[model samples]
Target: MRTVEEHQAVVTGLLAPLPVEDVPLAAAAGRVVATDLPALVSLPGFANSAMDGYAARHAEVGTASEAAPVRLPVGADIPAGRTDVPPLLPGTVHRIMTGAPLPEGADVVVPVERTDGATDVVTITGAPDVGTHLRHAGEDIRAGDLALPAGTALGAAQLGLAAAVGYASVPVRRRPRVLVLSTGSELVEPGRPLQPGQIYESNSVLLAAAVADAGGDARTLHFVPDDVDQFLTTVRAELAGADLLVTSGGVSAGAYEVVKDAFRGLGTVEFAKVAMQPGGPQGAGTVDGVPVVTLPGNPVSSFVSFEVFVRPALRRALGHTSPDRLRTTARLTTALRSPAGRRQFLRGRFDGEVVTQVGGPGSHLVAHLARANCLVVVPEDVTELPAGAEVVVVLIEGALQ
Candidate 1:
């Protein structure tokens, strides 16, 4: 039997970083930048106003107040996006809107609220310091400065910054193409009436969604029969376009284990029993030069196996700096017992400081898995943990708090 870390390392070694491709900024969200991106132009490219006000020389209106106002002639009306701006002459002001470029020789901006509403001439009742309400050129970022560094993940704010820095498209690692397949003789699709001996096939849907959440492009193949030759042929036919082949079923020690029976003789793939609860039977290698990872048929086992092994590998291949799920320590709300010599990942619900077990340690309990936001880890040597014991929890569904 192999340890969990050994299997994780073996699975992670199967994939390499994908090639970088230029994608439009609209489609660059959730992708990692492949190289450092420099700003094409400085932020606020020119001096502009931060508020709708009057742009004037501070020396002219430095002592103006509400009781004794300093009246000045309005030389021009400047709104945002005006490229050709006239200069402010001595003892004059320009009516400026927010984001409008400041005219030459103007050193301050007095907000319109402090002055009476006027068009031909304006009243400057309040005095502002020089450079007040002014957005200086290159204040946020200078031209040719680093806008985004390599390995930075692009989110809403990152994409906005990229667009503001004059990037229409960005270079990012291509999403890995994953092909999901499930196999069983007594499996039937959902929404169809099930016979007495048949059960609904759900591993493909579960695995495919997990792949997409891990930043991989996923495509599912219909369940194959439990025949070895047919499974091998079907898998080979799809390997030409897939970067990784993920299958859930038939890898355990059983008479009808087609995945183990089909690939055991091949020199490329290896099957092993990992010393972990819910996800013991694991296999990984290449099939026709495309990487393949086989998981257990139980829904919880399949989901946990994907979370532990495949998800991180896919993210690493996509150039994510942090490939693993967020992990934190929380005190257990109730006592629990784990099997000796096997690492256990129990479904849990974490509320910042305390973690409560969702259900019993059963791999077939899919409902319990759905309600869980985290996985409470118990090491191989820990047979029993009393209440209030600090346990490591991996946040699987945004349980950051």
Candidate 2:
């Protein structure tokens, strides 16, 4: 059986970065930048007032005080967006609003509260230092400067930065398109009448949702019956635009294993048993030049396999910097035994400090899996763990506890 690390390495080695495309800024959120973006214009663009005040030379009000005020003529009203106002008159004040362009030769802004707001003449009761309350052009960012570097994951702040720098659209790495398929003869869709000995099909939905949560565009194809020819034909027909293909079921060593029988000698596909609990039988390779990954049919096993191998591959293809699930250390709240020689991933509820198993080590326990927020990882060397033993926990959903 192949070790977990060896199988993960194989899956990573088969993938290549997806192509980049230009998308509007509104759609760039959660996408990775493909190239460095430079600022098109300087921030603030022009010298403006940071407050609503009178613009004047600070020297003119040098000795003005509450007891002895200095009065000067109000030259003009410089409201915001007034582009035709004349320069400041010497020894006079200009009534300026916030964000309005500072009149020429004005070195300071005395707030209206300090000066009597008069149209004919204003009284200044205080002095301000030169260059006060002035927002200079390019003070925040200069023209042609790098706004955002390549490989930046665009979130709210990053998208705002792109738009502030005048980018209507940006070049971003396209999300990987994943096609999920399930192959089994004893399976029927939910809400459909099931025959005796048949079960509801769920692996395709589970794997597709996992793919989407890991930043891939996922779509599930109809379930393929346990026939080699039909399986191959369906996979081939849907291989045209898929960046990656994932199939659940029909890879184990069974007489009617459609996936194994159909792709036995095709492309570079290889099937092997992995040294892990729940999900052991795995397959990875290419079909018609598109990367294909196969997982076990059980819903829990399929989800665990995607979390271990396929999630990282899809995230990497989408240009994400961190592709692995977030892991935390927690103490076990109850004793548990794992199969010797196999690494175990048991579903559990993690409460920040202690992890309690939700169910037994069965791959078909979907209800217990639903109540789990983490996967408690047990190394192959350890067969049994005490209640207080420290275990590595992979946060799958809910809070990071």
Question: Top TM-score: which candidate number?
Answer: 1
Query: For model 1, what is the C-alpha lDDT against the true structure?
Result: 0.93
Q: Which runs of model 2 end up more than 4 angstroms from their true locations? A: 52-86, 90-98, 106-133, 349-357, 387-389, 397-401
Q: Return the lDDT, model 2, position 112.
A: 85
lDDT of 2 by residue, 132-208 (tens): 88899889888899988887889999999888879999998888888999888788999999899999988877777
For all candidates, the clash counts are 0, 0
How big is the positional error of residue 134 in model 2, measured in Å on the Cα after superposition? 3.9
Among these predictions, the greatest lDDT belongs to: 1
Measured over all alpha carbons after superposition, the RMSD of each candidate to the real structure, in angstroms, is 1.7, 3.3
Model 2 lDDT, residue 192, Cα: 100
Task: Give candidate 1 misplaced runs (Cα > 4 Å).
Answer: 398-401
Candidate 2: lDDT of 311? 90
lDDT score of residue 169 within candidate 2: 99
CA displacement after TM-score superposition, residue 189 of candidate 1 (Å)? 0.3
